[model samples]
Target: MMRNVAILGASGYTGAELVRLIAGHRGLRIAALSADRKAGMRMGEVFPHLRHLDLPPLVRIDEIDMGAIDLVFCALPHATSQAVIASLPRDMKIVDLSADFRLRDAAEYRRWYGQPHAAPELQAEAVYGLTEFYRDEIRAARLVAGTGCNAATGQYALRPLIAAGLIDLDEIVMDLKCGVSGAGRSLKENLLHAELSEGWHPYAVGGIHRHLGEFDQEFSALAGRPVEVQFTPHLVPGNRGILATCYVRGAAGDIHAALAGAYADEPFVLTLPMGEVPSTRHVRGSNYCHLGVVEDRRAGRAIVVAALDNLTKGSSGQALQNANLMLSLEETEGLTMAPLFP
Candidate 1:
């Protein structure tokens, strides 16, 4: 009873990560892979690390026979997935790793992305794929929009406090640092080794980052009112991982207790002891997310930090987690592997 799945845009970092994770999965099989430009080439050619696995050759989206596929993981770029997904079979289950369907409001999509949504109907149906918070909706959803990496990291640190009214909603601030892989495999002058190595600076300053749209949408829905957090992301030199440091107005002990209580049963989210901090290196190359809370020097202030692999728990690994629930498989299956460490 192995469910056959396909990875669209198989040439990117997230797509390769999916192949790696699925290679260990017992309930799923890689039936096809699509890479418009890399079609007819082997996945190994595009990603040497994945060369060991016996995987299908890359093909164009039109070449894949959807009738044999049970699920599709869309890792295509933001504006591209809308058209590609609309062309797929209506009944196919999809876990999109792109930002296309993450926002519920089409108007918000246009405002953030600067274009009208190409598939409004699909946008309306996509369940926000923050696996832990939207489990039931994701389980029943035919299409699930994976949360943004930065958004996911910040939420893991603050969602419980927001939900429990333990923190001041108006004073939330998140400063995140992520590796370059989150930028994808696309060639960019700024990403060149000479430019990126030995240097790191913040971009999308002043809450202009696209992931903020996701934060506004999700946090607002949780608070039952408009909730806008000051969020800024920086591109660090590492190859993988995201570390989000969120500052909020609340008691540090209560923040720790709330997070520990919230994720006490979650297999992948580990809430550390009070005052300890999480680092991206510890959670690298795994689906796990480590969270910690610390008291600020000033009273009534707290610092919460969360760390996770951007390519895993932030994207592909999360996609797999949601797909597991969608496919009725064990939620932790293929995702419980220990985080890679030195």
Candidate 2:
């Protein structure tokens, strides 16, 4: 049976990506799409590329008849999603693609986002939406908090090593590069063509990036102690994909074996041949995360690289994957499409 779904904030990049992926979904159908500013406008008007799809016109969140929807994808921004989702029908199955509920602690959320969480109760109930690592929890969760794109990429590269006790927990370092699309469709001078085109530079340098909160919460839990990684994210000149290079203290062969063993049975995550590196181009527009590992010239160190489409695997595609589990639909449904290439 087809499950009717609603997508809030359908005017943004992540929201539109949800529509794109859902277009191919056989078990889920878009019953309503909400974009406040674009209310009353056809989805095609806001996203010409999606014009071919026969979808509902954008509407105010309240304008939609929620009774007809089975689940909702909250693609709204951080604080916005919190309040909006808080007031939503308590029984509605939701997948929140925001930073609002990712962190388990309200104090931690306040410390990182610079505001008190509007929905502490919901935050406590939301399952962290890193599909591969938290499958069972997500399957039973009423609300799932999507992982940060950068954080997801880095974790894919390092989490297995951390869990298997293969890498030096104290010396882990991740340098990640993301495409401009991860910034969302918001207008900003810094993301303008004149400013960001043909250039790439690191932001949130040091330990200030908010995704650190997630890494801290998840890695520490897995390691049974505090594990702080030096994470730096750079914005690259591209439309999609994330490439994360993780430098860790471990043998190349050991790191390779650990990663290969961890993701061997997992779908959507592929481990490449040893000494092979993945390029962002390889996984663009798909739900796949490609990982590669190699030895560093300096003994006892390995360079592990991971590539994925931040908008796809890191966000909406992941949300959809979790939604599938929550709804008991085939896990791979609507997600089997291969990565698009030139």
Candidate 3:
């Protein structure tokens, strides 16, 4: 039987990505779509790439008849998904593609987002949706929070090493470059083509990027101690992908073995042979992450590079992967499309 799914905030990039992925899914069906401002419009009107599929007309979340929805994918903005989800039926399974439920502590949410969490109880129940790492938790979770695209990329490179105690905990640095689409489909002064085209520069410098909280929480938990990394993210003029280069104090061979062994059995993660690096272009539009490890000139140091489509593997596709698991369906169903290549 096909699981009926509803997508809230269905007009955004991640939402559109869900629609695209779900349409091809034989075990999942899109039964409802909600987009507040874009209500009454066709899905294709918002994303022409999805015109080939038949989808429900966009409506407001309140209009959704949750009784028929076996799963809900909330692609709403940060701080918005909390209240919106809290009002939904308690039994509805959810995969949130927003920052609202990613953090487990309300105080941490406030510290990073500058506001207290709207639903503390729900916040505590959300499983962090880094599928490979949190698969068991997500399989039993009523709610799953998708990781930040940039954070997800960085973690793909570093998590295994941390878990295996193969790298230094305190001396880690992540330099990420992401496509503009990771910012969302909303209009912004800086995102304008006139302002962004042919220009690339770093924003959210220092330790201020919100995703750092995720890195801190997850990495710290894995290492049994507080772990912090210097993270700097830059906005590059492109459509969809994130490339994270992580610098850590570890032997290159150990780094390779750690990552390779970690994701060896996982379907979506690909660790390149040592000395070869990944490119965002290689994983574009697919739910795959490519990782590479190399030795730095300075002994005892290694550089790890990871790449993935910020929209697909990072957010929407990830939500779908969890939803599939929650529904007892095959995790890779409808998500095996090859990465778009030039």
Model 2 stretches with alpha carbons more than 4 Å out: none
Q: Write the per-residue lDDT of candidate 3 for residues 1-342, one digit (tens) a residue.
A: 988999999999999889989888999999999998899999999889988888889998888999999999999999899999899889889999999998898999999999989999999988999999889999999999999988899988998899999998889989999999999999999999999999998999889999999999999999999999999999999999999999999999989998999899999999999999999999999999999999999999999999999999999889999998999999999899999989
TM-score, cand. 2 vs. native: 0.99
> Which pairs in model 1 have colliding backbones?
none
Per-residue C-alpha lDDT of model 1 across residues 126-244, encoded as one tens digit per residue = 99999999999999999999999999999999899999999999999888999999898989999999999998869999978999998898889889999999988999998999999
The alpha-carbon root-mean-square deviation between model 1 and the true structure, to one decimal in Å, is 0.7
Per-residue CA lDDT of model 2 for 1-342, tens digit only, reads: 999999999999999999999999999999999998789999999999999999998999999999999999999987899999998999999999999999999999999999999889999999999999999999999999999999999999989998999999999989999999999888999999999998897999999999999999999999999999999999989999999999999999989999999999998999999999999998989999999999999999999999999999999999999999999999888888999997
Candidate 1 stretches with Cα past 4 Å from truth are: none
Say which prediction, candidate 2 or candidate 3, comes out ahead on lDDT. Answer: 2
Ranking by lDDT: 1, 2, 3
Number of clashing residue pairs, candidate 2: 0
